[model samples]
Target: MSDGEELTLADEIVARARIHAREVIDESELAVDLGALEWDVSARARRRAGLCRWHADREVATIVLARRAYERYDWPDFAGIVRHELVHAWEFQQFGESGHGDRFRERAAALEAPRYCEAFARPRYVLRCLAADCDWRAKRHRASKPVKSPDQYRCGGCGGSYEVEHVASGRTWTTASGYGGAKSALGEEW
Candidate 1:
């Protein structure tokens, strides 16, 4: 697509959200109502596709999209996430509250938004079952507590210990060696 023909994700969100907002609550100045709607990208969000937060003090709503989710999903699929967050914004504007309750679900249905986003799949870590006989393993996209401290966890299949490895670097850490040159979780020094 040409640069002129392209809209950044943030711009696309505002344009689509403006139209969707009007549909949810009727107002000629709903444009202005949604002018307070802000868009941001979140690098730390692991599981959720998007978040809608209302700032009571500022009387504004900010929608944050997960950077990994957007990178993995096509625009069409990601549009559903935008719609879901918009439903939250609409609910707050009209009902003074927003959540996964009856009203939110009804509004979400009318907007064709999904109830929940799919799991993030860009795996950065690999968890391997250390039982010599057990071949079970998992690919993880986030460095969650369990993934970071595999020693604290046991494999479900063999009840064996685990080894965590960085996918790209092939750096492996096990209970015996302690990860990151330290003798345990975090590091040997810490």
Candidate 2:
């Protein structure tokens, strides 16, 4: 596309991103809203397709991707891309760079989004049983807490020795850990 055409498309993308930023700010119920900040977002032909925040005088702004990245990546929708950037906008409004802490993780999770608002595919982790015959597979954003240590395993058909792995606070450990599990083994087959 010509320079003028690119500029127009970039403007449109920024406008939509700003709107979504407002929505995220409202939904977060953060101390400061996106409207309260004096920021502007525009698209640029960057190597990577993503959003970034620019802070100015206590206010934060964002710039999303332009046609280059999207065109290269075959992005289908603009709204989703904008929404992801808007999340960063909301983060800036809330905690000013530190907003990406546990609270942010919680809010993002609560959003029930398969991918970021920006439409970038979320990270995926594949879990497979170590056993050769076991074809059990699981996909998750984060790994589940381990109820048992790596030394533990259970047989579904025949009762085998297995320890439960408890995953909490983003840490995984076996029930045998000091976190209290001995008394909790009610019907444990192991």
Candidate 3:
């Protein structure tokens, strides 16, 4: 009976994903009732955009979307992510299990849903080259392999060394400081 008093962000994500599911899929062949499925948004989903969780009995299933995905992607791309998760749902509906299997691929291709969702990460670090005439820089959302010890790598543009900059505070993060410790500005020792 209330207009906007009790809605959360998950409500919005669930509502929109349901709409996209209907628009992109024809559920007549599916044993799982798409209309009766539960939906939710995951706050801790950093590596993936979507997921389909099926109960052990396979009689119930839920499609979960990543909260950060909506913040990072545009509508069309977001819709594809919803579709990708739905393909998993569709597969589970038929076989009681789901993965990036062959049948899932066929349905995904027919429905124009991507087989995989683009990864979601917020750019927290930047690798900049100090080459005399080169202006090369790479944005890294996480401290992955290449960012672990940036000084150990050379810029492809001119074989120059790198300086890792922390995007949040506009300061250069010392590579030797490792990932967990508080990043020191340019010259502070680890």
Candidate 4:
């Protein structure tokens, strides 16, 4: 095949995989009904691909696919990786943190996407971080460590602030801010 033709086919494969990922997420009914989510595809050379983020206030989520991984793996496996990441987004919305703890694992298993932590041992790309209101721009880099606690950043537009902290170990999330709306960024209404 011509180089151009091969590249086009590779691109198509990745595109199809991303669509499958979204389909799986939609079918799970686990993700928040944020109307529509965004998808991005790029090569590993570009550095900032194969990541996903969810913006709570905006009710939007974005997925980034690494171009290299897309070209190397089959569509089903690639889609599986995407679905795995989407689970983090769902967990973040329901709880917080894209951790691989019991709750995250349980939810992922419920969606038929079990944890493949060992897969990360290889030099393969990752679909990382599924949190709302996080602007973790894509880069061709792997996090040296998993995120321990969710971040707390302020919004430039609305001046609203939110913090994502882990509930106790083995505990699920509930909409309770110890100090009421005044102390919680999500507010009492949440």
User: Which candidate's lDDT is highest?
Assistant: 3
Q: If candidate 1 were superposed on the true structure by all CA atoms, what would the RMSD be?
A: 7.1
Which RMSD does model 3 reach against the true structure? 6.0
TM-score of each: 0.54, 0.42, 0.61, 0.47
User: What is the C-alpha lDDT profile of model 4 across 1-190, one tens digit per residue?
Assistant: 5666555644675567556766776777676544455666754433332565777777566666666666556655666667676776666566545677887788778767647522321332222233465543221133222211213323333334333222222221212332233234444432
Question: Taking the tens digit of each residue's C-alpha lDDT, what string does model 1 give over 52-91?
Answer: 9888778788888887787788866777787788777766
Report the Cα RMSD per candidate. Answer: 7.1, 13.3, 6.0, 16.5
Error of 1 at 132 (Å): 12
Q: Tell how far residue 161 is off in model 2, in angstroms.
A: 34
Pairwise lDDT winner, candidates 1 and 3: 3
Write model 3 residue lDDT over 1-190, tens digit each, in one string.
Answer: 3877887777888888888777665543434467547788999988678888887574667888998988788889998888778778766666688988788888788767888776787577888887778999887777776677776678867888877777776666435564434453334532
Better of 1 and 2 by lDDT: 1
Clashing pairs in 4: 42-67, 47-139, 47-140, 48-138, 48-139, 48-140, 54-132, 55-133
lDDT of 2 at 119: 26
- Give lDDT: candidate 4, residue 123: 32
- Per-residue lDDT of 70-120 in model 2, one digit per residue for the tens? 554443355445445555656676656634557656655555321443323
Distance (Å) between predicted and true CA of 101, model 2? Answer: 4.6
Computed on alpha carbons, the lDDT of every model, listed in order, comes to 0.71, 0.47, 0.75, 0.51
